[model samples]
Target: MSTFPGTAEFYRQFRPGLPGALPTLLDQIAPAASPRRLLDIGTGPGLVVEALLERFDDIVALDSDASMVAVAESALRTPLPHGSRLQLHHGRAEEFTPSAGWQPHLVTFCRVFHWLDQSAVLARLGEYVAPEGVVAVFSDRSLWTAGNPWQRAVRDVVQDFLGTQRRAGNRTFESPGPPHTQVLRDSPFSEVTETVIPVRRTWSADDVIGYLYSTSFAAPYLFGGRRANFEAAVKTVLAHFTTNGVLLENNAFTVLTAHRPSRHGKR
Candidate 1:
């Protein structure tokens, strides 16, 4: 069974895109050599690939989920820049092997790093990354854990219907251990730095419902026969906190970057 069945359309409609400044930031930081290449792992709906389409001569986007891969492939089929190529793969990161001489200049894991075997994936990536390449991890806090009143209300409703523990696919959700920074430190890409981008999100009641359905924890199938009732509760909660059918959120998008030491072992 697919980990996230029936949520691909909701994901495309509700998931937030990366910051507009992300490409320019990468441009300044990554190697400026011609034919720059990017490998975006866990590329749900191809958000990172779409954003960096202009930045790389070759882009490979992979996800373990077949539904997500299908969505990304359909969305990213637009005409590309001359000489640029896009490849979408439906496989786990550790199982994927780069084509000969296809070392990527940059490898990115956006929001889905925790879903991976951190150490194994990093070790595997080290073999495929160019010497001057960089690895970046991107993530953001979800509304379930945010401090806003509307967010709290939404979380409460979900828990009331589905119990306290979070659900991911068919199993209970478990957080990956030791933190991403510590894992990066133990890898070949030991030099690490962080950047945070503040984001403002506006949502309507229906938009909030769509976003929840897009998540593994609160997907429509998880609600079973009571999906309509659960949505009603969420809409009622949103109605209380939203003004004129709008709810505002202040969230942070965090980027953790790691790379081999520069000349003289400097960062």
Candidate 2:
């Protein structure tokens, strides 16, 4: 069975902190109009959902991975003064349908859409988003472009791994992102918009290794036959970069948002 950690472990390297920028990510997506309901598809651990709960009254989230979904569900279920405005479910995006009773005002897939079938995902997403609802595809790019030099070097090593093969979810802490993984262009979203936000996270060397292990493809490669080389590369990366005790990664990515006009369904 495939695990979602391919995505989870990567970001969790920066976890306990990555979600701090939620307010900014939310603003970039234009929650200005007030969403009645929100759905976070592939919501790894509800980082985005926790952000949504602060502004929107109702939220629904789904993740295909059991572990990822568990983390997200636990986050959403945390108690708040006004109570949680969030609902959590575990399932694949293809099997997830808009419940007959509710049409969400927004839909989102963060950092994991590339793993799904775009056309099918969108065709189904269209049904859930109220006519004027918006769909967002967000990624954090700062780690690829920003702070530390060693991080940049380590990134080069990891990408050499990915570019030579198909790697997804390179979630190194303080690590920048690899070049944009080409996503499906003309899918269900009627209109698309994107913005890049500058951000940073603190990380340790071990964090980077775990981050690599969380990749959709990198995990298998490292844990597979190339384990020695992969471990050696990580050692070389850390030895070259470690100064004092911390590594800073400069990365940036566009917060891409696509909208489906509200006139298409329940207003």
| Candidate 2 structure quality by residue, lDDT tens digits, 130-212 | 66767777666333343467766766776676564334434322323332222323655656666676666557777777666
In TM-score terms, candidate 1 sits at 0.96
TM-score of each: 0.96, 0.73
Per-residue CA lDDT of model 1 for 67-160, tens digit only, reads 8999998898875677888989999998889899898888999889988989999999988898888899988888777888889899999999
**Best-performing candidate as measured by TM-score:** 1
The runs of at least 3 residues in candidate 1 whose Cα sits more than 4 Å from the true structure, single-residue gaps closed, are: 262-267
